[model samples]
Target: MVTLFDLIVSGFVALVVLPLAVSSLVAGSPPPPPNMFLAKYYLAEPRLMLASNLFLLAVCATAIQRLATHFGVLSEPVSRSLDIWISVPFVVLLLAFLGLFIKAILTVRRANRAA
Candidate 1:
């Protein structure tokens, strides 16, 4: 009884959201003293911590929603809304990570060309 909407949501989560979450979690680790670049610009510890917590919440929400669906607990509208709401932090984190990634790339290229 999976609908097109369900398929699309699942695909988006699997393809994009999950990767971002895992990467953010990994990158969020405290950077070494010599690697201030990561701490200051790319993946600040505070941001990573927040993103990690949000990622946990997102996982829990998804699991709960799935279990509810299986047991016929939540309605379609409620489930849809939950999915959309849970995606907000992920999307924001994704944008932030992309911005930092681009900046890091450009900085590296510039440095390489200068040498």
Candidate 2:
């Protein structure tokens, strides 16, 4: 179980660090075709893939922080069950969003190529 301090520290690092790491990873990839790829995300006016990664990472980090801190306050089965309840949904949401996003990108790429 994570302590409040551990949650805070790890969550902060996750919010700040993972996004930077993901940004670097995306930066190394070939740029998306104009705005088409990113437009499907949120507001969608215009933004970098790094922005999306940062946004998603921020959400996960916040949820993780909350979960960890909450877990620290509980005991035994309660803590463990709470941890599972909190973490599982967040993870599922994250995976769902990521899969959809990747699928959209590939669809766009294929269309762009076929055109």
Candidate 3:
């Protein structure tokens, strides 16, 4: 018999895994292809993906912090500083990813027109 905790853990795992799997499928191809258009695959969208992963990490950290708070534990002031540091990278990566996504779309469209 699965306890409530077991079910909750399974649900959390599914929530995390399903989106990643879907994103990979949507990406359609691996990164590092010789063709620029083909590189639009999930692997190639590193910046965007990294931002997403980092966001998830931040969420997990917040949850952990809350749990600690509930337990009357004090976290260091460093977590706020760490959050600021991570935000900078996330913004940079997100912008880079958006630029690449636009470029990839244009490249694909051009190829289709040429063919």
1 or 3: which has the higher TM-score?
Answer: 1
Which candidate leads the pack in lDDT?
1
Model 2, runs deviating above 4 Å: 1-8, 11-72
Report RMSD (Å) for each prediction in the order shown.
7.1, 8.4, 8.6
Q: lDDT score of model 2? A: 0.58
Instruction: List model 1 lDDT by residue over 76-99, tens digit each.
Output: 888889788877866776666566
The 0-to-1 C-alpha lDDT of every candidate, in the order given, reads 0.61, 0.58, 0.54
Residue 49 lDDT, candidate 3, scale 0-100: 50
* Cα lDDT for residue 110, candidate 2: 75
Deviation (Å) of 5 in candidate 2:
9.6
Estimate TM-scores for all models: 0.46, 0.42, 0.44
- Lowest lDDT sum, 10 consecutive residues, model 3, at 62-71
Poorest lDDT segment (10 consecutive residues) of candidate 1: 40-49
**Residue 6 displacement in candidate 3 (angstroms):** 20
For all candidates, the clash counts are: 0, 0, 0
Candidate closest to the true structure, highest TM-score: 1
- lDDT, candidate 3, residue 27? 69
